[model samples]
Target: MVSVKSLHGSAQLLLDVAGGVTRIAERTHRTIVREINPLNRLRDIAGVPSKEREGQTYRFIQSTMSSLQQGLHRSLDGFSADDEPTHSVHSEKVAAALNGVCGDHLEASNNPLAITMHFRNSQGAKLRPDSSSMGATFPNAGPRIVVLVHGLCLSHEYWKGHNEADLGIELQRAHGFTPLYLNYNTGRHISSNGRELSEQLQILVDTWPVNVEELLLIGHSMGGLVIRSACWYGSEPKLPWTQLVKKALYLGSPHHGAALAKAGHLLTFVMHKFRYASPFALAQHTSAGIKDLRYGNLLDDDWEGIDQDEFHLDIRKPVPLLAGTRHYFLAATIGDHPTDFSSTLVGDLLVRLDSAKGHHSDALKKLRIRPEDCRVFEKLNHLALLDNKVVHDQIVEWLV
Candidate 1:
């Protein structure tokens, strides 16, 4: 039998060990987030234009920042990974570095965001034909086509982080892929904007605006699911799927559902239990938050396909579900988990691996994607992965 004194001593030792490890890891992550992270977000001199004409892109975009200033609206705050209070000194230093380093880009990320979602309806003109139809010239290659979709509460500027463009450059040089940033109302249902997106893809592919070998899509958070929904519905649209898409990747995407969203809903029901914050919070019931609520049930057996009725959005295109495409899942799991069930702590602080992969969905189980189809990278999170160069490197490798 164990003596009481010995048991007490062992418990204390274990606690001390756990505390030490947590402290070390938190500090390491803090250093990484504080140091390397801002570098990824830098817009100053990170990208060098291939030619003199291209340099204007930076100067042009930077000009927009001259008129922009910080806007007042509280974004959700994250507690330190260390669970300790944030030091004002560190905060000030980080802020100063950003202002100095990023220059215009820093100003853009700070506040008064820029919204760049201007796309035209270029539908149906035959962008692809395997030689015999439009000669071998069609759908071969050109400037290249790329699609970028942003996550919640953000605009295309999210990807404007010069680090993001670095990824784009890699895609172009290595795989001959171009960049196209997609912007949609974060408040709309998946199906609503999804069908619209599919239609857009169809048009983008059908037209011979440029020779294109591959159509790549990069979506973060809800953006990932939106892309899937578009692909699912787009495959059978009037235009057809193969004409448009090639491959897609999801970063920190909650393909299954969000755990924090589920928890937040409970709090939303009990007013006093939770404080009403951003319109992004739960105030907009029909927003992405609500969409996330019903999102988990997406794997329902009847989920063979989704449309306006199921998601409560106006689906502009026909909802003919496709089987599955050569898609890849790149999730930024929390990385270091000191627990038995790593899945729980796997995703960014808010999302778990299981939910991000749509594993939590009974609906998806009956569908094409099985357990084997997923790939998780534990080093990323919702925001970090976007600016993180390592994440872009992996994407370039896969796309190429």
Candidate 2:
């Protein structure tokens, strides 16, 4: 008995209802958790009755109370990690802890802040593109600039400082390349930030008054995917390589897609159902999330971030970046359990060899990608690829 227009109207109303329900549900759940957390803490302090008691009746009551307390804690805590801080410190503090950058700012910055530094300042951000005074320098006389991008849920701190020269110092010393680390929020959708990153890079190139002889790019984990996405948008045959990028190197880049991101997608499903998940819940199933794991988003515009219907990065899809740009790729991986299932619990306490490689390599092959790439090392985790002296030396030999 319903006409087409009525059906359309009904659909729209249903959509609105669903949206309202989800938003209210999430907020109410969060609030209830906030209120009950203190109660549970007090219960802990007061000493919940022990399961093992002196009398028979006392033992039954104690055991029941213990079970109740456990349930209460689970209900209140939800998916939040035990002992995790409710509030985050300032960005400066995060930066210092991650890389020792801005001490004073760390005291002022707060959580959910973009993990990455803005190469452009507040004033520059406000100015017209033509009027902005932001500086971008690519000096021919001094060292070459190498920008390092970090992976998901991580800061540049992921670049361990153990190996001689580390990745940055080694690249600088061996190739006369200066290292620049780029940090950004991993929580946002990948392409949204990637397009932003492309513009940021363009702005950077414009501000640099120096004549850049060459530009070398490096990325870790999700950072690898961002560089790829950036190149996809920015590269063109008409553009002169000399005017912009020269070479890009991906360490543990997920060229196809990542396995961990697939797990994240699954987790997002569970979290959404339970309504007690972190904002990171979206991080798991988003298109950007899938892309970071090595699944390519070739067929659709994934920025909208819809669920299973969303397109992923097609690993085997022909890359859009120009061929002559001297692009190099390296892969890293770990075990299979958390390895294939969770990016959080992968190999070497960091990345699985498979995730690192974006391909299955039993021995954790370290190889150069492009024009018949070479595998230099056989066994190293994602972090080791950056922090290990051997990897740095290998990179130097190739660049030189």
Best by TM-score: 2
Q: Candidate 1 overall Cα lDDT vs. reference?
A: 0.50
> Taking the tens digit of each residue's C-alpha lDDT, what string does model 2 give over 124-167?
12222331342332223242567777766555545644543457
Could you tell me how far off, in angstroms, the CA of residue 240 lies in candidate 2 after the best superposition?
5.1
The alpha-carbon lDDT assigned to residue 12 of candidate 2 equals: 36
For residues 283-311, could you state the per-residue lDDT of candidate 1 as single tens digits? 32223323443343222222335431222
**lDDT, residue 147, candidate 2:** 70
Clashing pairs in 1: 127-206, 146-180, 148-180, 148-182, 256-358, 299-362, 299-363, 299-364, 300-363, 334-346
Cα misplacement distance, residue 127 of candidate 2 (Å): 16
Minimum summed lDDT over a 10-residue window in model 1 is located at 68-77
Off by over 4 Å in 1: 1-143, 162-165, 272-290, 293-324, 337-343, 361-373
Residue 12, model 2: Cα distance from true site in angstroms? 32
